[model samples]
Target: MDSKKSIHLLYAQYLANKISKDDLALLLDQLASMSTEELALLTAKFHSSEQISDLKNTEFNSQKTLAFIQDKIVVEEPRKRNKFTAWNTIIALAASISIFLLFKVIYQKDSSLFRATQDSSLSSISNQAYLSLILPSGETLHYSKDLQLLSNNSLALPTKDVKLNVLEKGQLAFEFSLEFIEKFKNKTYLIATGSQASCTIRLMDGTLVNMNGKSSIQLPTIFSKEFRTIALHGEAFFDVSHHKTWPFKISAKETEITVLGTSFNVKAYQSDSHVLTSLSSGSVALDNGTHQVKLTPGMEGYATKSKGEFNTRKISIQEIGMWRSGFFTFHEEPIIDIIQKLAQWYDIDDIQVVNDHRETFSGSLSKDKSLTQILKQLEKVSNSKFEITERRILIMR
Candidate 1:
């Protein structure tokens, strides 16, 4: 068979579970030679309504599927075999499955219910010692700093310990553990930090992300040759990897921040009125179709979700990133707003402002303090007093 038609037929047979051992090897050998456009077409095929419906209803068993694929693979001596059977198909199957799962992951990523129902072990805790790592194949791994390393390899460590190195000037460094690097190429991952916890992660492309409490980020499965992109929910500080040809872009709510190389903080909690993008260094452009704003170092761009409009202003870079340094820096910020942040950082669920008094706080408070201690400090500064009840905090005048 000619190469082009063989490529089509090979995929067709594999999809139909009719591929022979020889055909599998042939497809494997040609995978590296196939252009990205050609592979994109195959990925598109998996998105058809019929295929998508089947995938949604089917329970995918990766181990069973791999075992079946392995049984069909055979190695043959070059002198005794044809071109198709010169090498075993195991390597080819691994590559093929990686591509197939990459598409499948992107397909199911938008399901809010699926994201909400991750393993209970990862989500049940109100406070977490480590960040939750959601694998592209929908596995959850929890790692803490207490883990002891037994090997130099990232994956060979005894436990999944995500390490963070604090740097000068509010910058943090994090490297993906070995287990993660294995799936880094073709799969995207969602890293989530709990309400009482914050974490820093470094993407495969060297972009550093400081995820605040109750925040999550959807990292691109693959940083495309054309652009590097990520989607954010809640808040994060991004130290982007610069590429002159490939700009780094972050999509948060209705607003998008595009930068070639810059450090910025984005806040887009679902409950907030505006999406805030504050630049720490270099330059960033914020866009929401109807409006656009360019921000330089020590400036912030705010986009109102309701109006789809944007505005810019000068801001303090230290205030923008103080949360990473275990402090909440407020500058005449509303009392309710401060309470909301306190609730999120401390995992206090039933916080209510009983009085709608117009009071704003302007100061910095250490996050390491207890809830009562911080509340007492705030009360000493503002007109509000805190009343602690059973599992609730009431702010009254």
Candidate 2:
């Protein structure tokens, strides 16, 4: 039988409490191998089917099944050779299944879950925003409003301030405020923000990082006694804690920024051709392997992918990290670049420029404004027309 049919049969057996251990393992393995699109389709099919509904109403108990599955996962995890990848996939599968089952129960009791909003399409787009935490053991944890709801209702997820400590041997330790602690650690952890989403993280040593949309940062759970180092992709504003004995370092694409204690903004998205580091306070040294430059407050250091050399220019201190303050500030930025920024913030996929306008614009706009409102302002300033259809935008000049 095909994979979907096999999964359907196995799931039905599970709901009826008749699936064997081998079949349950097979089901999870197959589900893990499927792509996100495939899994979503399967979920929709399962939810719409009368057979599954009948089984759920009559025979299925979510709590018992969840416990059984958790036990199976614990038993099977040790058998996998590539534990990291396998464990992450298994955890994601478990969460997906748990949420799917739980949502069914919640929906039956509360139809308010499906209530429509005025801007349903915009709501759908916003739903795609998320923050992901990848632990060293390859376990991935996701945080979002929707996931928070599910977690609050059923999952024992940690809420509020939590500290992470990296332990030896792929173990991670979580220190929760309520004196709840757990041992799960690795040397490094990755924090990522999805499109249209931003997040702030406080490092163990009191460094504050404000991440932009579609950005990622990788740092050790605990900094070494000598120095603090972290890798960055995309963009972030960092407020480094003053540690007189230890220096802080950021590794971006083709550039390394070292400082004692200072506030700075770094934009190094891999898709972009240039890496930019703007200093707001104190001093920082930027090295791009071939060349090095020191930047003081009000100075911006940039390196192009083609030249891969450090270049410095003076920029207004107020222009640094404007996004963090709910504003988009552009200073003679190319029209395409401006549109791309909007696309990243709005999570819009389809963008078309009707004419090849090499116009550069300089202005500031509030992020609180709607896409249409912002576009209208841009049209007035740049003498360009913007047409929005759903999540797609067209520009003409």
The candidate scoring highest on lDDT is 2
Model 1: how large is the Cα RMSD against the reference? 12.9
* Consecutive 10-residue window with the lowest summed lDDT within model 1: 112-121
TM-score of 2: 0.58
Candidate lDDT (C-alpha), each: 0.66, 0.67
Instruction: At residue 194, give the lDDT of candidate 1.
Output: 70
Which pairs of residues collide in candidate 1? 154-178, 155-178
TM-score of 1: 0.62
Cα lDDT tens digits, model 2, 187-285, are: 455676777667667777878788888777776556667778887877899999998889998877657789999999999775567888999999999
